[model samples]
Target: MFSFSDQNGFCGRRCVWVNGPVIVGAGPSGLAVSACLKEQGIPFVVIERSDCIASLWQKRTYDRLKLHLPKKFCQLPKLEFPEEYPEYPSKKQFIAYLENYAQKFDIKPQFNECVQSAKYDDACHLWRVITVSTNGSTQSETEYICQMLVVASGENAEGVVPEIDGLKDFTGEVIHAKDYKSGEKYAGKKVLVVGCGNSGMELSLDLSNHNAKPSMVVRSSVHVLPREIMGKSTFDLATMLMKWLPLWLVDNILLILTWFILGDTQKYGIKRPSLGPLTLKNHHGKTPVLDIGTLERIRSGDIDVVGGIKRFNHTSVELVNGETLDIDSVVLATGYSSNVPYWLQETEFFAKNGFPKTPFPNGWKGKCGLYASGFTRRGLAGASADAIKISQDIAKVWKKELNHKKQKVPSHRRCISTF
Candidate 1:
């Protein structure tokens, strides 16, 4: 019901003063925070660039994609997936859940209004959220001022397709995983999927299942763990252990378990680094792929595993090990960049690589009414927890300010009567 009407104008401009926080992006993080704000009776506004909620999951993701982690670990605060749903739901089911969540909280985000820039005003002690909208031949700009600003755009804001030598020289089609839908068109064709991350592994498996001769380009060392261990979801067990055990102990125990479960990956041409999975994750913020089928595909000889790409030829790719294979298409699953620096260029909110220098799980909230959400290394659950914590913190500040104002009201009235 929020609008940019004449009555809502402020500072002689097309502005609306939001009493609560202004959250950018209507994804999981933003919705979680919105739910908390509603519970606290705080008026807030969420501006989203996409046309619908959870567009990242609803639009960009492929049809074959599913939740890598169990639904129990991925649920937001006070919102759990139905018991009828699977432990790991498909992309469509997950999107439906998010839509239901937004509806349940009556959270309506302003869609199709992309945030162009944001700045904190020192004199006013507020944030200015600038947005632009285009309708046919007309374009208009709008500004929003709020005391608290939450940037919940999430980490995968931009797709990253790594540049390689002679990429243009290839005659076949080239696309990023962001554009990949289904593997139907790739059936019977040799496709090279670059990167061994979750997307890469999953996409390669999808292609293989669709009758495509898929090969995964394992660029560097990666930890690939089985999705299930001894009849239980590895994620479920990990969560249970993480709550009680220290990180180091849990990490080492999982490493030993993986070794016993999957044996030596190097023997099958899968080389892992010397460090453990959790160590690599903590140091580099890399999520290890929980394999549901990719490992089995590799063992069954349905999918081939190759080294990193050296370069692309006419219809072939040369690997770092000097191996060349004729490929019909190439899918870059290299992953995504945070793209924070592009929007927050003036602020020290992010590093040069578009990732937060002091990322979440420690220092997501900074001074000057600036806050970050959904940038945690622990994925969805961590992002949800961060949103709830941030909303509570903002509520505490508002409470203190209201109490101070209440204390001043009685004194101000007595002084006026004396005058």
Candidate 2:
């Protein structure tokens, strides 16, 4: 898939020198890191595969998608959302904010450049990044050399759909949430929503609002919560509570509150896991859906909540609870893969699940000048903090290297070079 442009054909290799770090992806994570580097007056080249930045928010998300967390928590390092923005901004608003952030920071990423491979050269004490650029039928290759490589492709780089039995044979229509834009196209159709994550719940609600019959296939246990309780944002409350109380105590309080508000999920056949929603999120990084109106819709029977999918037939899908229903289309909100294993050469750097092995800010540091960011599952705030720390680490290395280089040069040469 890698190609280089040449006078003769498309296999030429050209070296592009980057005096500082080489960052991958121009999403929030990449831009956050770039901003931090810019603050320190560091020179880095951000390589984005897509034509524009923040492609996830720009392209993958549905038309109705909005930030689950408040705008304050979601803002990048130094930049803040407009005062006129709502508590939660829509997908487009967030993308526009990122665009503004990039422009404000003067982060001009090299667009349409897909990273082919990155390898560390211990002999040269540098990292090699090979990128391929494609324009129609033409392809160009550029090899970049830098002391550091930042992988900010984010956690959800690739969509992951579970391998359901007989899925490929189903004839109606199949699509992942990544490709789903709006429910207008699916109005009046019987849709089966797979996975009960935030995307799934929100998508189900969107379909219901558009007059589509959505039957959600809950494959496993999940946590659901109202977007607010007692006029306070649940996320905002949880963040504050975690700062003061122990996790176990916080879990119990949240459970009690959820019971008082939403009552028993089992009444509607939604299996609530033993672990508290916040506890589960902190431990496994799986977030509960911040129910806006999805719960009310589900409770009112506007949407049908079903058990795990057993299998699929041509015209219908069977549930594990021995119920079968005709489905006109299937929309998978099954989330995404970490995408770290595909690029990094060092297998030890990844976890058992194919995600990067490191955690939070530490995970930003990797083997052989390679660092992974935006995969912490901490959302925007976490990514921003991690990016800042990683940039600080890089700055330290850059300073030491500069000092070493200065020491290596003869006094007369150093004095002359200063001019």
Candidate 3:
């Protein structure tokens, strides 16, 4: 139990209380974790920054976006999307599904609540979660002390705006992929899309379809594979191969398979770089941007593929190779950067880029009780993977605590087997 005190000088009163695990961000990953905990009869509180769960899908995604992977493999365990839904759910349908999932599980998360800071109390062995809720003209602060903390904040929240020279002087409207919604706004306008990721490619196509005359600016080579290969979804084939082959070998095979299915990308002035470690991390495995017949649109002069932006004047953008083009707007399909805003500058739990360095032990490290999911591109299955891993990790810690209380055993001796 905790007490609340009101100070006349402060804006609002604070509520202090002890609770179960505190899960932040109500995307698919957060909702899935909450569902799992519910099944285990574990009490938990889910905090979301938006008014509804999966708001990214509902708000940020483009008009024509659909899940790249098939529904059978992309859904959460023991949960099935509606039979009426297509094999590849559209962004609208996906958001509805998430809402349905929450209702089915009776997961009434505290919406409009944005987490400001989460800090661990060494003395109490509990996590203190501070949040701000804005509704109408009123704003309130709340705090929760929980035994565990799960960060389900998906990687898409913070848009990764690249450092481009002379961008600020361009005088044109510039927005990141997270701010893009529909192509209708850009209709009859010339739009430059940076990056060849799914957002870049899909948004370009969407804009073209809406008569926007969009151009894609590619800096690095991209591997554009067909949605299906050999009568099977490319995701299924990749999953099968990854199970048996090393990453390098798997990439080679995937590239070879893609070549036969989608043809080489080099013909369109786009080169496929050497397959290195896939940098685009999502829980779905790998971010697969389906060609979606956009190549034909590019060939027909409906969409232009340009190199990276070097500098931009008020009305024109110069490419790295010195090529210049005038554009009405610039949509940075640039991707996103991870952030742990609550941590202090001197905190050893975070990397220079603000991501936890631990969970990815070999290439990741961070403090215990703090975890991030949906950062690694596992693909359309990423949300499920994040949920599974976080749930398992929390269960392990919870079991250890329970055992210590019931059997007088050391936490180390009572550790739950992750395997």
Q: Pick the candidate with the highest TM-score.
A: 2
Better model by lDDT: candidate 1 vs candidate 2: 2
- Residue range 63-166, candidate 3, lDDT tens digits: 77888788887787448989999888988888888888898888988899888888888898778888889987999888777777777776667788888888
C-alpha positional error of residue 153 in candidate 2 after TM-score superposition, expressed in Å: 0.6
Q: Summarize candidate 1's per-residue lDDT along 117-226 as a digit string, tens digits.
A: 88888899888888876546766667888888888988898899778998899999999998999999999999999888999999999999999999998878888898
Residue 96, model 3: Cα distance from true site in angstroms: 1.2
Per residue, candidate 2 scores C-alpha lDDT tens digits across 9-117 of 4467677788889999999999999999999989999999899999888988899988998999999998899999999999989999999999999999989888878
Candidate 2 wrong stretches, greater than 4 Å? 1-10
In the order shown, the candidates' Cα RMSDs to the true structure are: 3.7, 2.6, 5.4
- Give the candidate number with the greatest lDDT: 2
What's model 2's lDDT at 113? 89
**Runs off by more than 4 Å, candidate 3:** 1-11, 276-288, 341-349, 359-368, 396-419
Enumerate clash totals for all models, in the order shown: 0, 1, 22
lDDT rank order? 2, 1, 3
TM-score-best of 1 and 3: 1
